[model samples]
Target: MSVYTQLTNDQFATFCQSFGVSFVRAIPITQGIKNSNWFIQTTDDVDGAYSYVLTLFEERPPADIEKMAVILNQLDGKLPVAAPLSVIESNSVQTDDDDKRYVIHYEDKAITLVPCLAGSHPEQTTQAMCHDIGAALAMLHETLQALQPAEQYGVPLYPWADVRDREMQFMPGDEAKLMSDIWRSYTELPLTTLPNGLCHLDMFADNTLWNLQKGEEHLTGLLDFTEVSVEHYVMDIAITINDFCTTWGMAEQGESVNFDRSKMAAFLQGYESKRALGLDEKRALPVMLAKAAVIFWLLRLNVIHYNRTEGRTGDNIMVKNPDLMKRLAAYHWAHVEKSQNTVFVLSGTTSDNQIIGVFSSITQAEQAREKLSNSSEFAIKEYTLDQLS
Candidate 1:
């Protein structure tokens, strides 16, 4: 009952044949959000055996497919991540007899077949993993900064920001109002200025695969670059912190969870190990984290929730609660308040003073009205005023 289109076994075999991969067997891998994925096993006549992941992009536009491919191509060597192989030359993917192209389908969705990464995702986030993730992110951010802006691929540091704004407009009642208020708070905050580059916007825990060979979890590869865009480094940092440090559900339940400040520090340490964040970038972490929370909330509300309402259900996906949006806002605000020094407030001296003065005047006026109400002449004057006026 997944909303995404599924490729039949025969059609999948033909698709693999087109890419010179003679498929022996194919099994669906149910671990993605926006696409239907399958692990296709191919007989390697000379090499022995191999498997590749066929990602049938459901509900994704061709423009997004091309944009991700182009960005991934640019980021291939820069970070430890997976990039889709080009079936046809010049960033265009091929299709089977069913008219399914490598990155586009007849159903107006994008599809791509990627080499299956040979690592398992860690069940829990550890300090070592956090450090590696931090370093990986930092390295990725550095690489992105070195590259040119990819406006075609929608590469703003806060790409989801735009999406959230659109979704808030359509949501109902208090939910929509709360979303709007959080978005306004983010907009009002001064943003960090950093060099723009390609960003892997969806680097959550599930997207990361780990290799635990040496009794220590090492980051094997980063997966799912569908949300790749051009954005600031802090935005990525904010997302990492929100995903790894703040969310309790991500950690083992009933473990007496504490916000691993050391893990947080380790992540920052790794990031700085590659390229140092500027003063503005470091300062903007709390606001960026708040923005990240709001962004994820809206994404769940609009994309996941809407899909569920349309009857899309699967092993890996579920509709997010609307109430969680308020909780997320509160969490972000608490963090932002604690880290206010890092946040850039956009109010000027004159504007700030005027606001304070207005509040003071309102307080004084309320006190004067209360004093007048307690006086005996107050009722007489009110009656006289009513008669005269």
Candidate 2:
């Protein structure tokens, strides 16, 4: 997380009083990458010591950031979301106009205070936790699908075309070629009939909070709504699975990246429990996974460029390793190359289709086939994947 704009304790205290809040302390939050965040402590006569998260919109348009309040308001009681708080204005009283949003002008930058969500990011996610996260995302999408016409969320999908070009100049030959191939595969893929709606396009592990009880972990909350926009539900699922199911191994310590099959299984199980994936979505998932990896790889490369060009360091910059995204893209593309990547589905003429598994290798497919051989009404078939020519 980066704090581009600095605020003194006195400045914070005065700002707190505008909402009838007395400041106690502020601690910089170093987990976020796109925006500045601070953990705020406050006290008042009615409520004793309380905590909140103070945020400054760095890259997002202020108007879009303000619209987040509306989205959060929609999700307040429905999900484990930390909605923005309204600050009192004019003689310490709050009204409709005065409380349009929690956002305020701080040094000419947009800032908002939201309740600090419970739980913390899990260092390593388990299959069960992945399941919980999957269910939560399904609920998030289902709830948002009602808000129609794409105008509700004023944000657009990341301009991958423009970003890919800008960052490719700095990339090496192999990396650049890989990026170009993935971009071509992504843009040429058919997405016209995919289920589209408002989606949290970035569902990285760090953005989710979890509570470990006894021996199992439960997904308690979600963060970072800045990237929410209208997109394909399948694409949203791909973004999340790439982050939650993949194990970077000791990669942070210079090892290898691996995707966990069991974790992916559990995640898909939970997601289907809420909303089952259609045939077209299942067919598109593998390529979508690769595309998701490509998007983040390029975006993080851009983030590195921004941080370095401005001579930014420390809490003023939050940069993720674009290399990991590269490795992830490579891994998924290798599977795509193996050909006919799709989830397990029964396609016999006399029976209802049910997705039972997803794999890249034929041996795994054979094993699944053997298991289903006992049932005469079930048959395994290659998915009719529409890859870009």
Candidate 3:
């Protein structure tokens, strides 16, 4: 059975008391791909008065948890992120009636508490925000290039290039092949050289939060470091762009939504502002984006889809928007090809077919390139159609 489970009011209150906090109420927060989270209110009366977010770490071991926390704490000082908080002098959230560690025992499982961060997740991406996110990611990659950790945590045992290799073991045949091919092509593209760092491997839209004040939203908090790993920084960027920038008709219809390119630019601008990309990185952006798409595609196929086939409720979002998983995979393939050609034909004007191959619309691609040229902060050297092969 899947690991997600809910804590009753009594269990929540008792858990709070053990942590030297008085609980007033508790509400169910969204369950992530790995952990089940809850927002607990406390009588502490502090500005960010919430006690903490409760996460049940079912799949990850204690050592993995410790490593993730340590890596994130190191990165938090340098980036805009909310790292995990360790429970001092205790192995569990509470001791049970049978003298078992409630949080550590099978019933509570690998439960943990993290300080709540104040912010809302961005429903849509903007160019400015994308820039900030890009810059932050670049800076993170640069910083991570230097630091070496005591131990490697959550490194993929199998080749990440093929999603099928991993999922086929659990799911059999052509269905698996389709999933794997989509992921392999998207993730395995050669783009910017890989630089090692403590990467937040799971940087989806919901995991990142935006602080709102006076009706304006700014990037504030990044959450859920459970999938934290030692990997390439570009991987994170690819994942964010693939998930947030692309529009899935099925997913949108189910959730009631539309696409916003301005938001995409906002995030990219934010990321680029902090850590400027070289020609290599820029040229490789689409391939990287494809790699990111494949990771989430597999995540949905393996975890979310697997659950639904077995008749489960833990992943309502995936279950509700089944078509999204397929649409995302298709979109990534289309964009990766476009980005690769665009980078190749940078110096001279490109033919309509070549431009179309890389970008969904030639006009939109041209506009994007033009915008990059006009922006004093971010300037891209022009490429003509004739020069592109």
What local lDDT does model 2 show for residue 378?
A: 53
TM-score of candidate 3 versus the correct structure, residues matched by position: 0.71
TM-score of each: 0.72, 0.84, 0.71
Find the number of clashing residue pairs for candidate 1: 8
As for lDDT, the candidate ahead, 1 or 3, is 1
Model 2 misplaced regions, further than 4 Å: 44-50, 91-99, 250-252, 340-389
lDDT of the candidates, in the order given:
0.61, 0.76, 0.56
lDDT of 2 at 22: 70
lDDT string for model 1 (1-389, tens) is 12256667788777676555777776766654566777777776234435687777765577677667665666677666567655553346555533423463546766676777768876567767777898888777666554454575553343566766677677678767656666677677565345556677778787888887756678777888777776666777777766666445432453232455556666776677787766566655656666776777766666665575777655545344434544656566665554332221211244232221111111122223333434222211111112334
Minimal lDDT window, size 10, model 2: 361-370
Global lDDT of model 3: 0.56
Which of the two, 1 or 2, has more TM-score?
A: 2
Please identify which of the two predictions, 1 or 3, would achieve the higher TM-score against the true structure: 1
The deviation in Å at residue 132 for candidate 3 is 2.1
User: Which candidate number maximizes lDDT?
Assistant: 2
Candidate 2 per-residue C-alpha lDDT over 1-389 given as tens digits, one digit per residue, 9 for 90 to 100: 56766789998887766555678887787765778878788864234435777888887767787777777777778889998877666765446743565677775567778877788788788988878888988988888866667666749777888988888888889988887877777667678988888889989898888886747677778888888898899899999999899877664668567788667767777787798878677767778888899998888877877888877776456677888889999988877776654433444555456656654543244334544545455565555356432
